[model samples]
Target: MGYLLITGGTGLLGRYLLRDLMDRQQKLAVLVRPSRRQSPHARVESLMQSWEKICDRSLPRPIVLTGDICTPDLGLSPTEIKWVVENCDSMLHNAASLSFVSTGRDAEPWRSNVDGTKNVLEFCDQARIRNFHHVSTAYVAGCRTGLCKEDELDVGQEFANPYEESKVEAEKLVRSCSFFDTTTFFRPGIIVGDSESGLTFTYHNFYAMLQIAWTLKQSLTAHLEPDGRTNVSYFRLLADGTERKNLVPVDWVSEAMATIIADESLHGKTYHLTPRTPVTTKLMCDVIQEVLNLYGIQFDPVPADVSTMSDDEKLFYHHMQVYESYWKDDPEYDLTNITAALPNLPCPHVDSAMLANMARVAIAGRFNWRDPRVAADVNLGVPEEVNQPNVVKNPS
Candidate 1:
């Protein structure tokens, strides 16, 4: 049987992909870093314990291998490397530094996104690999303010963060690889919770604002941001005081990605794995506020004027640098490629209420940032860190 290999096989998106692949009984192999003390297989097993929160019943087990992308050939043992070289048929490049505000220039994105990608491509080349699937973010559109579509490039806008530039470079690298037989690039927009259960693995996307909202519910922070009118799209602006967060469930992303790989018709193209119906930032903020209020916490609505204040008052403004670019991107996808491939596969649901519910659970469950140890006053994500006016980072 043909074997499949995944780089970020343990990430939120990787969990879904692994589940789908295993359900089909596809022989799968995943690259994992050997822990200082534990074995590689043990590390993957520990990871699976965490994945139970997101994966469906169709999930299957994975064959984990000890490897590191930073080192040569994923730090694989000589024999293991040779074995993978001979048996592997398809490769999924999903591992990446999703955090936009990284420790340093190279540490932030260039290494995993660019350098790591080159290494993966090289490994395949040396192994005589055939199929390759690269997962990317839709933020590559940068500051382009309009309907972004799949397979379209060069909008002439710009990127808001270093993460965007890195993703674009990575995609370019995948497209340029000479020996790879089949390549598919999946570009997802502001990925978030599980559509059905409203569950999320990490606290990202609009979590910054929700952090404040969840805090307000507990009478923790006295913040006053816009109540309506948040400019979220090129067409209908989500007025200030309006909070819009476009999020897709991990289940949906993995399912779509798996289906794409299973089908052969789609190769040498890009696919936008975005939510069919995104929630307005306003509704996202409102639900959290109301939920807190229901819990007997007093949360007074801060006027839009005070809400949109600069970093001095709006401490979370720093992190908005990565998210601010999302103000636009009311995309329209053909779906001809996705729907055609997964004829019977069900689409994951990620509407406003669904996302809000998921947000509620994730926040109440783990994102209690108010705890001093959980980073109560860091505010490392303000828009000012973006290094540009309005935009998040400087373009190279």
Candidate 2:
């Protein structure tokens, strides 16, 4: 069997994909960038060890190709290029920069999502690799409030952040490429922890709300009177607690992607890996209040100006401004393609119990706080700046 080459194999989705594919005894190779203190090979080995502990079994190691996605030819050496050309039959492009805010015109999300994709395409063209799988995000629908279909790429809609804009550009590039005989695009929604154990390596998106709620709870609790009552009536949010959020478990996403990848007949199609029953903002707030022991929390529409708001409200909104869009309503995703492909594989419903479990795990993990073992297990090849603190900062 020819080796299946993968990029971002050390990332959250990539690690799960590696586990699923390796379990099938498929030959594999991963393109990884060297870190500040560890080589590419060392990074892959560390990830594999973590996977072994998670799965409770030994897994076959993948061939590690030291390279950078931002550079031409992925910065691969002459011998490494030859190895890929001779042994690799297909490629899975899963690496991406997850920065929501853009630092500059040509920085971060743009460099990795747009430029990195171009480089990967160029390399694939030279290597004569036809079959390709690209992982994208469903948020590429942007600020559109209606139903988003799998067949749609650009709808002339406004993007909430640079990350969404970059992914849209990248997907456009892949769709336009003519050299690839088979191109499959997998667009996943807000990916959270595993459904069963609520275990994840990183925290953002929905988890950001949890982080904020936890911080707010601690802050308010500090001033509680002897009867456990404070002057603060209710914590305000920018949403009315009825907006829907499409949150799919990371395991489900990986499984669905892997299943689609293994079937050659399913190529040349776009799949929106989203949940059928979305979790509501009210449910989220309820769970957060329960988990963090924060009562009297209320969600409401964001005011035009916060100049006249109370000190606590201003402080809370100031810190949560970066994630304001996430709290708003999300578009309805069309999952026709995925539904037909995996008719029997239903997306798990994210209920109150499930949210509680995820919250428990996240709190226990301290929102993936820096630990030597966690670092070794969850490096996504991005810089330290991209891994910003998950907490919402309080204004002085």
Candidate 3:
């Protein structure tokens, strides 16, 4: 009967979760921070409106709590806090910093992943919200090879990046909390765009290579061969063309999580929202080469020698250094919990054609480096008062 309070409602997976949950007629409230250009309410309004346009139906908006997860009480005012205490009984902690590197413990990957989680736990304890749902990455397995079960968290494994390290710490923090009656964790693999639309808002890990190729294509346009292909023959990727990357579509991840969250019996367990069949590096590269008209990229298992590398290859490797561990190979993520929960809902296979479609979409949008800030197309039932910045005024 109480509203489900969620963070990270503006992210790619969060947007899909909002749509799927709203369709199921769930009472929801979202805690979102204001951007420099838009207020929290405005941001949610824009997101909901965008969904409405895409789905071709009117949708109800969640109660927008203007707050930052990194702040105490999530920066909510006394009145806002009272409303949440009275209305929200469960929370989905989804806001996270995806920074792969950390300058210090005080900076990102720590600020949003660890400290932000602590702040959320503190608020929940204060508000007496007992049920908690956490969004974690499957990579928290952290360079561990072979099968990674849903129930496992820490196995004395080493982390490839700071993002994974911070997530492990956050998961430990969440599990350590004793106030919650139910705790659920959804560990999704690399999230790509929608399976059907191939549309995505965020481009980070998987898109890095595609982006690099696209950028090179633009600058090297004059050197294109008669076959409309750009010569990337000198560039060699540090892989055997057999490394598998577990990619889950954002829509599927949202649906799987929503289904589990909606059912009370399904609580208190971990779910690996990953694909049954992982896509290989060769397949991904082939798609990129075909879609982007890139030619002659060799896959070498050994690390490239810096002395013999071309300028383009050097630039590519430099830009991709942060995700070096990410590209190594993904372990097999066990889908025991999610498979049992949603027997009928199978993860869409991301075949080469599908991957190509996704690539085309990204290429068309030029990788969307900046937030487009698309305004609400229809100003339906959004309360006028919520639109004003005073709805949750910043503390003076």
Highest lDDT among the candidates is held by which one?
3
lDDT of 3 by residue, 1-396 (tens): 798999999988888888888878888988888788887777778877778777889998888887898898898876677677767899999999988988999999899999999999999998889999999999999989988989999999999988999999999999999999999999999999889988898887778788877787677433578988888875577788899998888889999988888998999999988888999988988988899887787887787787887677787778766766777788888888889989999899999988888888888888873433656333322244433443333221
Tell me the number of clashing residue pairs for each predicted model: 30, 0, 0
- Work out the TM-score per prediction: 0.76, 0.89, 0.93
- Let me know the TM-score candidate 3 reaches against the reference structure: 0.93
Cα lDDT tens digits for candidate 1, 192-298: 76777766556766665566545533442433336532221111112343333346677778877777777678666787776556666556545654544422222
Name the candidate, 2 or 3, with the larger lDDT value: 3
lDDT of 2 by residue, 89-195 (tens): 89999999998888885899899999999999989988878899999999999899888999998979999899999999999999889999999999999998899
The runs of at least 3 residues in candidate 3 whose Cα sits more than 4 Å from the true structure, single-residue gaps closed, are 221-223, 369-396
lDDT of 1 at 188: 77
Worst 10 residues of 3 by lDDT: 387-396
